[model samples]
Target: MYGWADSTAIEVLCHTEQCVVCGDLADGFHYGVRSCRGCNAFFRRAVTFGMQFSCRRGGRCPVDKNARCACRACRLAKCFAVGMDKKAVQPKREGTNGNGIQSQDNSFDQNDSELENRRTSPYFDSVQLTSPESTYSINHSIYAQLTDYTPLRSPSPPPECPFLLRLCYEFSEVKRRRKCMLCKSLEEILTEDCSIRDPATAEDFTVVFQTQMILMFEWVEKLPEFKMIHDPLDKTKLLRAFALRYMLLDNVYHTYELGYNDRLVFVNNNYIIPGQPSSNFNSCEVVNEMEICALMFGAPMQTLVSELVSIIHGRNITIGEIMTVRRLMLWNPGSIGLSSNAQAIASQASNNAMKELQQYLEQEGIEQSEQRLEFLLLYIPALTKHTKTMYEIVRLIPSFGKMSEWNSFMDDVLRGV
Candidate 1:
């Protein structure tokens, strides 16, 4: 007998703590209850199904000491009165680590300790956003912002920062000016210089920063062994979008080195088209292996990718159109220019999408539209990566130049990789 009266029915006897909702002596049954059966039942219902009821009159509802259970709303308040810990409610599972795994102690505190280590980690410390504002407490904001994805957060930082940082930010205006430029070209730069300090309202800029964090957590969630393995080399690369940030800026710097002395390439002024130049196929686009390595260091693996897909499909996307609009405007500067290459790609994508939609025009084929959109989105990037135009345009940019002096530079980045 753990101090309960109705032995067969299991009614816990009340000590000094009475049910806050009902004056009846409470038993320790429902959610650390000290209330009556009605209140206990209410709490159990609230916890089990997540009912959100509001008092029509106001917030304060009465609770009687004897014949209690006045208002449904009052019962919930009583729950808080007795101290049901909200923090104790575990966060829902988001995704797995890079290795597709999880552990028993999935507490926020434990995750914070891990992030703190990566922050202080020598290789990553420089880029770890130590600006006190970036340091967060264990709360809803942190979880809402970062930890849900673990894989990308697991790796050490790239070693080529301070210099790389200086190089990328030098031509921030180009991103603003190059509205009609080839999208693949612009996207390449975005990916190359993804690690540059986030720009004000820049689409790719925000995506790079956000992706870095999301991928980091996703990386951890995917790989269970990442917790046990201290070796930094085992991590997958960051998303190409993020890696391109540094790579793109590096290419711009190389452009100056290559004597492509057109200031229009890097400045805020637009380059006028003389005529549609014939696409060249044989050019070698500079890769900036160092930045790519850094990008690789921060990439999310399979688990995170799956989670992101789930997040997008889980909600009614139509309601979030406004958010999508903002993201597109930020990332695809070409959205403002009808003639921009991004718009062209978008148009091409739309056409393909229309073909996918045609399948559902006659019947209950709506499900195929979702699948079609998904496959197209994934496939588009892969297809775009292989274009001759992309290769030519990327080569014209400077960062693609051969890094004769990369041995030392690479050594630095590899120290953390």
Candidate 2:
């Protein structure tokens, strides 16, 4: 258990890395406190002009990214409450314009030179602040630009978010890029053609499995947190912990998204329909004289499907929901074997992703959204259990048949454990 000081230190470290005014990613030390560029600008404007503000809500309003501009009084009050020093506002710095005339930069980033000097110190570790002439301010413009090229599917999510969008685009890109033997795109499956595919033969399963592994590698490479982990061993360990879980969830959800709630789906055009309780198989559908696929998939996989899918299906989940949840799965900070730095990245990224998930729920107007969020997070444990089940299923693959050429990848995946 943590003592008060320890807990307080932990809390401060977390908050220090985030903007105290509004919980967007911190740009750097702003007015003597860590804050995002937008909040830094807002505070400078408020303090420089000696602007006063009034609250219509008894001076108690939530000031987050979505509502930072909503309540200026509470926002300014919260700024001081969080130790944003008004005294740090230096007189506006002027630079020579194109006309050779000195003009003040309108961007109101107080103490720019000081922040610049501190940026190289061990204390500050965030993206660089915007240059005075760079016009990109609308709360999350920098963050939003990360996902600006990612085309939205439908019913766009809210909270001016990026994690949600980037994750979805990654999933879509991974799924869409893989085509059939005929070179047909799978994008149509999400809308019009999610027909239940027959169980794959051993060769088909091998090909699909190999394809998914490659896709997962590609997708993981694109993630910001994954890129931050510098150690090869840590990267491999994180991927090992996440690989089967990601493939399973992606396969299942992809299948579900194609309008099949009662069955578990896989890409490369195959799926697994749950069997009736106390059932028998021909021992010929997938493996060589072995009741593989659904048989080995068994009770645990069924529970994973029914429990996870029912909630998602019943609740009418959005693209944001599964992708945010996948982000949590991918960068689980508590996942064993990560180095301190890798784990720190995981922890911060996971927290931000969870916060975005909550923000998504609130914007959806879900009744009791916080409680619903708890319900969503509960699946994280279930996902772990399902991943373990997948390991067991993967172990069974070797005994089923003889395709040493096609089976080497699976063998390599299981190695060095």
Candidate 3:
């Protein structure tokens, strides 16, 4: 009897395949399962709309061609049982027929002559918006494609002496002017009388920077490469290098988010306007010190801030791009004192993050992705330049160094010891 049943199954397989759910003659495979056109369309619609169905009787209704329409809930359950894969379903293509009704093409054509052409075309891939999982799969595929491009290597060491000095000097001058402008704008804030003698207190700047550092630390913890670094010391070192730039970048983002006009940056509800006298010191002493600091280091910091804010606002940088840039900054392979092995790991991680970012940009349908990538690369140098300037300023200011000692993380960042 088993042999007879096997023979009957073979015979049935030899004939035109029937829909596993509806028992109607199958029209090839739809979403990885053989089903008739009607069933295929119904399944597509159900999945697309996230349609739920109720079976009148415990969902045991027999689903066949004639009775399939009687209980959609049972039919859908049977579709899944028969190995219908919703992930395999291609996104619906919209087109208009002569009648002007919007028609959806749900077919997944594996053997189309245009497949290779489409794959090679420089166009963004269409993603399924109906499901998060499907969107992720599509994004993963896009990232895989981006990974096919050359991997990024560690950047070359900085040029020695005069060249580096010249670059830093030019950058410094630009930064100085921008900082002066920022400070002058905030001078008005100081002119207004508050209860406190210091309009822009050191306590306020410290509070803001420290609070931002906490947020930055949390952000760094989320990156894959940072998490992979098992050594606490290494993590601390990386975080130390990352924190300042992260704070500056985040400030740029915040400045833009608050509207371009609202340039006053408040940290922990404390505003740190350049040139504002601190309540902790005599008015003359605070003014002279702030002026000296602003004249020396303010421009470079302000220049970096202005450039970053302008770029982000002008280009409408997405959160995804910002996240990717953060990863790049955090995993900086060129950071001084990293071992060869650490550099190698960082290079690979940075490349992977870049590829992911490329996919994100493509999905956003942003034009000139290649150009955008190059622009992002430029930010690395800007970050390095600004960081060097910040280091110099911190070294010069004994009080800032003392304040940094209050927070262990900030202390580690300041001393680098």
Candidate 4:
């Protein structure tokens, strides 16, 4: 266990470094590293265990200002203050390609270097991408812009950090012009196509998807499982968009699509802020809306949504979902009841659950919708949880094989099931 340095009255002042939390440069050691320790721990817990933190009161865990200690998520974010690389903590495989992630070696360094060179170029310098006169704010403006250009495919890992260039903060003295141009142009071109047709439903979907993505991204960043997955530098925008789309599709198939349009209208009517355009929506905000609905219905509805989709659509529905289905689908009968660790227990549980599902299908002749929905509701949570966990493991050490990693983590709990 890591020791907490809160009460030590110890302020170790250091040169400003990049803050892991907001990706801002800090002038002092506010957290564990050059950043604020609060963000460090928040990053650790959030990234390490994939903890879902809720503000006991509600909404926006304040960072760097008020409510600093209130939210676990925010506090850990403070740790990233000085600088906490979730990727740093992730286990490394021997002799991996660029970006230190396990994936097709596509020369991420070359791409990133080229981008960096362009940013430092004299031509781009003359144009001035990040000056006060420039109209774009990389973080706020560019990120919002790219949402319109959500990727349709899972892009291979790129050599550079996608999020870094994809969304940058408004800095007083902007240095890189080429990078700015690329970022701005990419956002402009990509986002041109990403408009929400039905503002209400689309907004809701956007919110839920954002929350999950943040959770997954931050979680994967620190965990060893991140290393096992593709490079974070890949076409991150595209992958993230795909992830978001999958969640939306799952939502539609599970319940949102099943319900009447009136319910959607009512939900959106009550949920959305009156003035804000539905197109300029935030994922967290939408998640809040969906969460409210979940509370109103008193149902663990998210799980059901994924499960229903997975059952109906046989193959792994989303990249995230695929991770889960693959884990569950790979269980061999011979591996059951053979051990007593957490892995064994989980495997056994999955094996048993699958067996029960098979049995349920065989024994109870229920309507397809009812049966599928019921199974989906139960299975989605399990699958998602496992998928999230597996991703965590992979992020830590990309070398971990599918079954080998699963078996090791769960121990024997899943053994001999």
Per-candidate local distance difference test: 0.31, 0.57, 0.51, 0.31
What tens digits encode model 1's per-residue C-alpha lDDT throughout 1-417? Answer: 111212221121233233444545455445533444555544543443354443433433344543233344444444443344433434334566779786434343355335333322232111112232233222122222222321111233256433222223322322322211211221222232322221111122222222222222322233222233332222112112222333323223323332333221222211111121112211324345333322211232122222222233433332112112222222332222233433454445445334423432223334455554465345334322322222333322234333212222122222221
Candidate 1: list runs displaced more than 4 Å. 1-17, 65-68, 86-417
Q: How are the candidates ranked when ordered by lDDT, highest leading?
A: 2, 3, 4, 1
Over the stretch 72-183, how does candidate 3's per-residue lDDT look in tens digits?
5555555654446776755567898799998765343333323222322212222233442333222222223222321112223356522222222333222222221122
Q: What is the per-residue lDDT of model 4 for residues 1-417, given as tens digits with 9 covering 90 to 100?
A: 111112111111122222333333334443223443334433433443344333332223334323344444333322322234445543212465577766643333345335333423222111212432233222223233333333212233455632221112211011111111112123223323322235443323323332333223332333232233342222122132234233333333333323322221221122222233344334434444434333322233334333433344543222222233322433322322223343344455455544544444444443353455355446644544433322322232223222123222112111211
Whichever of 1 and 3 has more lDDT, that candidate is 3
CA displacement after TM-score superposition, residue 239 of candidate 2 (Å): 0.3
Point out where model 2 deviates above 4 Å: 1-161, 180-192, 201-204, 276-294, 333-335, 363-367, 402-410, 415-417
| lDDT, model 2 | 0.57
RMSD of each: 25.7, 18.5, 24.3, 21.9
